[model samples]
Target chain A: MPIARGYAATDASKPLTPFTFERRNPNPDDVVIDIKFAGICHSDIHTVRNEWKNAVYPIVPGHEIAGIVSAVGSDVTKFKVGDRVGVGCFVDSCIGCAERDLDREQYMPGLAGTYNDFEADRKTRTQGGYSDSIVVREGYVMSIPDNLPLDASAPLLCAGITLYSPLRHWNAGPGKKVAIVGMGGLGHMGVKLGAAMGADITVLSQSLSKKEDGLKLGAKEYYATNDPETFTKLAGTFDLIICTVSAEIDWNAYLGLLKVDGSFVVVGAPENPIPVHAFSIIPGRKSISGSMIGSIKETQEMLDFCGEHNIVSEIEKINIQQVNEAYERVLKSDVRYRFVIDIASLAA
Target chain B: MPIARGYAATDASKPLTPFTFERRNPNPDDVVIDIKFAGICHSDIHTVRNEWKNAVYPIVPGHEIAGIVSAVGSDVTKFKVGDRVGVGCFVDSCIGCAERDLDREQYMPGLAGTYNDFEADRKTRTQGGYSDSIVVREGYVMSIPDNLPLDASAPLLCAGITLYSPLRHWNAGPGKKVAIVGMGGLGHMGVKLGAAMGADITVLSQSLSKKEDGLKLGAKEYYATNDPETFTKLAGTFDLIICTVSAEIDWNAYLGLLKVDGSFVVVGAPENPIPVHAFSIIPGRKSISGSMIGSIKETQEMLDFCGEHNIVSEIEKINIQQVNEAYERVLKSDVRYRFVIDIASLAA
Candidate 1:
């Protein structure tokens, strides 16, 4: 067994504190990674604070993981020592399960989350990556392409794949007008990815504060949702609108912005239900859908696509000790984009 | 001008009464039809009683029409005297407009409702097929196939296309498992049409009250949505769900029954917005969409398909005088399927 040191919330009310735990001995298909950078996701805060109310204490919450493969089990064929890789929201799912058989492991009922979830054995709680090292099955680990900095690529594991899956599923490409709602980590990645995918991109933010940054990130237009005219002027304009705002928005108004046969996809989830009228979708044959993070295969493809397009999350690097302060900024939406924790600081 | 006798609602508070109106003289591109039968849609009841709140007084509400072409204008090359024909929700849209040019006239802002709405001239209040006759542009009139009876085909004009458009738009066909919610007029059409399209049909009614009828209408299975186990057993089972009930439902529970990438399509408009959690659509990438009645082109296609398959509405025939009684029954969902008025009663 390898000893790993990380930070964890002992209870919902407390900040994450340094803790040492034993990682499982590598299975035949496992890859042991020396975590270089771990991206802090909004979900991490939600889980640690038990805002979603399902969090387990003593939880090490980080799923946006990027690292170098330090060792591989005897039967690990996909990765070699020193290979750059990453892991997303989950580390394992029962391979022969129905959802996995259909290549939809992310939705599998038996999926083991990277943190606060029991592994396939149902006895051991699988911990996550806010750590110095993580042991993952070869299949769950994704290769980070060269030239993309490890810190910037970390968020791609979560935010990148979250946006990429829907854009591809809905066929957001050339001649497609896509609007990304909110200018946070997920929405910013949506702009870069949607623009890279040849879509005419627009950023729909709460205000014009992020207008300059959004446009520079490949948005052709930026509109403030607080301004009523934004809704009026852009009515029935977009072929696809990816709502990255976790707050409950006026869903019907956004549905109105979709053209005939367009889709409004939600990636960010609010606690309560969003109310929508049949009139909004019926008149134009519009649809409202939601997507979670991509499957391992699709996640790899997203990373490769990023490699080709030079896409990486705009990240604020933070020392491991700065995580508590970073969480505060994330809650206020004050971060430039994403915050990636330097895992080496844990070693020191 | 031609004198047209019909039943009309004098106000929202009273029963429909015998009233007289004038039919427009034929325009150069018009087809004047001597009305034979008119289907009483739920919308007619909604309009007459001000349930939808947009009704203009003395409204003669009927749109699902079946009749004979009594006259044709000089440029009406499509129809001649005594030709069997039908007209649906609208009589005309702004011709040569972008949407009308594409044959999607129903979505056009200038679409003229068959009753209570001003004609394209913006001055004349358009009457409907409940009258003895109607004069409509030739392009908007559909030719009823020789094999289909005019009375039974009346509901096919409104109810048929309403289901067919969404069923087709969502690609309901062979290998697709389609669930038709609500077994009323619109839903029965969905059952017939979805079955004819080679889909594995299921009817999800409020209870097994219509189980025999549903199976007879070609549904392979019938489930009572009132049964909790039905939701559990059929979880993620359907590829398409067409909700024809105008009443608000537990939208999230229904959304849970869809398979990955499936759609819950609403053809019926409810008075209020439905609350849906982001969890319903996100994990499975499921969608909630809505479809109105088809385009003129698709309506023709639906009719052609119906004709080819010998499909028509299961109707209860009523004289125009009984329409008020029919309205009461419609509100109670007491009709076998649909009611088609004998327009000849108006002539009497």
Candidate 2:
């Protein structure tokens, strides 16, 4: 057993605080990783505050994890000591279903969250990567390319793959026009990935506040969604629109922004049901869809693509002690893009 | 100009009455069809009663037109005297746009409604096929297959293509499990078309009252949506679902019926917005999309396919005088599939 130091939300009202826990020793197929960097995802905030209503108490929430392989069990063949790796949103799913056979394991009905849920044992609760170390099955771990730095690539495990899967599924490439709604953590990755996939990228944000950053991230155009004229100007313009905002907007108005046979996809779930009109999609053969974080295989593909294109999340690295303040900044949409916690700070 | 006698709704509150109007004499590319049958669609009732809020008074409400081409202008290449033909929801659209170039003219911004809307000239409200005759450009008219009957195939012009386009676009075929979420005019066609496409079909009606009819129409399974167990038992069961109901439903419940990457499509617009939860689609990579009456090219393909499959609307034939009564029955969903008016009855 390894003694792991991490931050946990003991209850909904209190801030995350230092907690000491014990992680199981590596099993035959397990690889123990010394977690170097962990990205603070919006879901972490939701879980810590019990917003989604199913959050288990004493939750140590982090899934966008990047680390170095510290130890390997006897059956671990893919990595040895000192290898770089990452683990994303989910730790395991039912592996015998047809979806698993298709490598779309995230859709398996028995999927287990990386944190705030019981592991396959159905009794021991699974913690997350805010800790100093983690032990995961070999198949659940992904190899990070040497060219990509761990701190910046941390968010790529979650936000990066979330955007990448939809872009690839919808065929966002040459001759395609794509719009990324919101300029926060997930959306910024969409602009970069869409552009890298040869799409004409446009950013639909609440304001021009992030125009320069969006352009720098490979977006060819940016528009403020709050401006009425923006809707009129871009009506029927996009082949694919990926909405990363977790708040509900006039979904029908955004549906008008798509061309015939276009798709509007969401990566974030709003608290309330989104009101959509059938005519908005029916008139043009349009679609409104949603995607979760990528499958493990797709997540690995996203990392490799990012490495090939020199793409990594725009991150604001902070010490583990600054996590509470970082969460506040995140709620205010004040972070530049993403916040990466330096796990070494947890040890001190 | 040619004088045409038909029934027209003079206002939202009144019954349709006898009216006489003039249709333009053939232009160089025109074909004048003497309407032999007109299917009374729910939309015809909606437009006549100003339900969609865009109806113009004195509207002749019919779009599912089947007729004999009686006249053709000098340059009319597609239709000649006595040719069997059909007309659908729209008469014309902005013909030079990229959408038109792609044969998706129905999505053009300047699309002209078959009735209660101005033509391409932007004035002179176009009367619908409820009239004795209609003059349209040759390109806008589709040739009815020789083996199909004029009365039963009339609804195929609109309802048939509406379902066919989405099923084909979503790739519903062998090995796919499809569900049609109503058993009315459009839904019956969906079951027939989806099954004929080699997909296994299920009917998710509000009651098992239609179970026998659904099975008779080639559905392999029929479930009553009113049963709570139906939702639970069929969860994650379908690859594609086409919703033809125009009433608001708890759409998230139906989204649960889809498999990973499945589609839930709507062809009818409810007056109120459809509330959708992002989690419903995001967890499974599912989609909520809509399809209108298809492109002219696709409509022709649908008619040809229906011909090959021996498919046509299950129509209840009536005289012109029975139209008002039919409208009331349509409102109650009491018609056995569709209602087609025998045009010769108008001569009295």
Which candidate leads in DockQ?
Answer: 2
DockQ in order: 0.85, 0.88
Candidate 1 lDDT over A1-348, as tens digits, reads: 899999998988888899899899889989999999999999999999998899877999899999999999999999999999999999888898777777778977778899999877888888888999999999999999998999999999999999999999899999999999999999999999999999999999999999999999999999999999999999979999999998868889899899888999999999998888988988888899999998899999999999999999999999999999999999999998999999999967
Task: For residues A98-160, write the lDDT of model 2, one tens digit per residue.
Answer: 888888898777887889987777777889989999888888999999999999999999999
lDDT value, residue B167 of candidate 2: 92
The TM-scores, one per candidate, come to 0.98, 0.98
- How far does residue A122 in candidate 2 sit from its true spot (Å)? 2.2
TM-scores of chain B alone in all candidate structures, in the order given: 0.98, 0.98
lDDT (tens digit, per residue) of candidate 1 on B1-348: 899989899899999999898887788999989999999999998888998789888898899999999889998898999999999998778888777767677887788898989987989998888888898998889989999999999999999999998898889999999999999999999999999999999999999998999999899999998889999999989999999998878899999999988899998999999787999988888899988897888899999999999999999999998999999999999998999999887656
Give each model's whole-structure lDDT: 0.92, 0.92
Model 1, docking class: high
Candidate 2: list runs displaced more than 4 Å. Answer: none
